[model samples]
Target: MSPQARRDQLIALGLAMVGERPLEQVSIDAIAEEAGVSRALLFHYFDSKQDFHVAIARAQAEAMLECTAPEESLGDPLRILTASMSAFVDFVTDNRSAYMALIRGAASADPAMREVFDHTRSVMAGRVLDHAPALEIEPTPVVEMTVHGWIAFVEQTTISWLTDPLITRDELLAVISSALPALASAVGAVLPTAP
Candidate 1:
């Protein structure tokens, strides 16, 4: 495999393992083993475990952006918002383990990784506006914080749902959908007349 291919393989393997276990419990040797590469090669690719963690976080961010990128301008605000939520839930459900490990590790250990989390939050907020251009709200630090908080809340909720299989998808969607009004209100955006 080419160098880039090997790197991709390493990242893919890392994501797979995160689903299997928590990040703290995951080992470099194990990652190397799963990637079918030498520990030394893994080290060569990433200077340290921390560096590798950052790389994985970056890859995840890119993957998420690709997944949620609007194919066309979803002209309707509510439709766009609901579509985004659906995509988000699907992403979390499909990559539950990886998202858990990434969130846990980024929140605790990696500054760079945390930045990726922040960027994702901004994108989430931007998605809101993209779907509803007439929100009549100005971009401000407060808006950013609100968006960030909403993203974090959704992620945490999704994490809990992933851990507890009892939460049905519709139930999760209903709970999340019900909260959109509050989220929009907090961010100073106008909510639609009805659900």
Candidate 2:
């Protein structure tokens, strides 16, 4: 296989293994064997096992962002927000293991891994701020802080839902959607009166 192809293959294997457990729990030998390559060859692609796991974590983070991004074609802010939240819920449900590993795994405790995770959170917050205009909310400090707080709530709620799932997915989505107006109120943003 070509060098790039081989590298990608190894990374793919790493991601798969990570999906099964936390990055720290996955064995390098298992990943190498799963990829049908020698352990040394896997090391050749990554400077160390930590690097390999970091790559996987980064990939997972990127996937989450892509999955949760709002569809630009939706013109209404509320509709766009709802669609994005639905997509986010679907992504979390579909990739439960990966979601946990990336968001709450041992790797998240590492500085490098945590950086990737933090960036994802920042991006999510940025999206909310970006949509502020459409939502008729001014992006003031209070609004920004509220957005950050809401993102944390979303993360924790998602983790709980993934772990227990007592609530239906639609119910979880509704809970998230219902929070926006309150968040706007907390930020003192006067939303247009709902019809």
Winner by lDDT: 2
lDDT (Cα, tens digit) per residue for candidate 2, span 1-195: 999998888778777776677677777799888888888988888888778878887888888899888888988878888898998888887777777877763345578878878888889989989989877777877777788889888878978988888999989999997798677875573533422
What TM-score, computed on C-alpha atoms, does each candidate reach? 0.81, 0.89
Q: Listing every candidate in turn, what is its Cα RMSD in Å to the true structure after a full C-alpha superposition? A: 4.3, 3.8
- Which pairs clash inside model 1? none
Position 179, candidate 1: lDDT: 72
lDDT of 2 at 186: 56
* lDDT of candidate 1 at residue 131, scale 0 to 100: 46
Deviation from native of the Cα of residue 152 in model 2, angstroms:
1.0
Clashing pairs in 2: none
